[model samples]
Target: MLRCNLICIGKLKEDYWRKACEEYEKRLHSFCRFTITELPESRLPDNPGKAQIQAALEAEADRILNLTANTFAAALCVEGEPVSSERMADLIRTLSLHGTSEISFVIGSSFGLSDRVKEYASIRLSMSAMTFPHQLARVMLCEQIYRAFQIINHGKYHK
Candidate 1:
């Protein structure tokens, strides 16, 4: 089975978000071995300066990189290439065919990811140009990943 790991920063404190993630994870069981690893987000003040935010993102990147070792890394960022659901499914299939059974997706905190993280990514994916709450992003990503699997399998869940 393919191993899909979602390495995200920050915890999902909302019940709804957790429930939503759990649902997708359950649905994905037949497709791939999935795991969600939440890393600690760097603390910042109410009004942090650019430098401080950059520093924090760098720190988070270090942790993310460490956790994603030995996997094909994909970083979720606003500047990343946006793809349709079908394309995502194709990408997943291609990776699997290439013998990359382990795929890791990195989701940065509110301040976003550092350059180092982006550089480390084998592919950069963007959900949208608009910003979303990190917790909610996790749920969305999980759903999309499940949908991708369904699409690959020609299952009705994706349609």
Candidate 2:
């Protein structure tokens, strides 16, 4: 089975979000060994400057890099290329065949990811053009991953 690690900033504080993530994690068991590692977001003032945000993003990137080392990393960003569900499934399948069974998805905090992190990614994936709350984004990514696996397996869950 493939091993998927979600290295995301910030924790799920809401019950609904937690439940939603747990549900997808459970569903994904049949497809991959899924794990979520939440890193603490950097604290910032009410009106943080551009330099402050950059510093925070760089700090977060350092943590993400350590966690995702040696894995096929996919950074989630608004500027990333959009991919269809079938395309995502094909990418995963191709990666697996290349001996990259461990895939890591990197999600940044409100400040977003640093350029270095994005540069390190094998692929940069955009869930959509619009912005979403990081917590909701995490759940959305999980669902898409599950859907991708289902599509790959030719399961009825995907239609």
Question: After aligning candidate 1 to the native by TM-score, how far in Å is the CA of 63 from where it should be?
Answer: 0.6
Model 2 bad stretches (over 4 Å): none
Overlapping backbone residue pairs in candidate 2 total: 0
TM-score against native, each model = 0.97, 0.97
Tell me the number of clashing residue pairs for each predicted model: 0, 0
Local accuracy of candidate 1 as per-residue lDDT tens digits, 1-159: 999999999999999999999999898888999999999999999999999999999899889999888899999999999988898899999999999989998999988899999998999999988888888889989999999998988898876
Give the Cα error of residue 108 in candidate 1, in Å: 0.3
What stretches of model 1 exceed 4 Å from their correct place? none
TM-score of 1: 0.97
- Cα lDDT tens digits, model 2, 1-159, are 899999999999999999999999999998899999999999889999999999999888899999989999999998998998899899998999889979999999988899999999999999898888888999999999999999989999888
lDDT of 1: 0.92
Candidate 2 structure, TM-score to reference:
0.97
lDDT of each: 0.92, 0.92
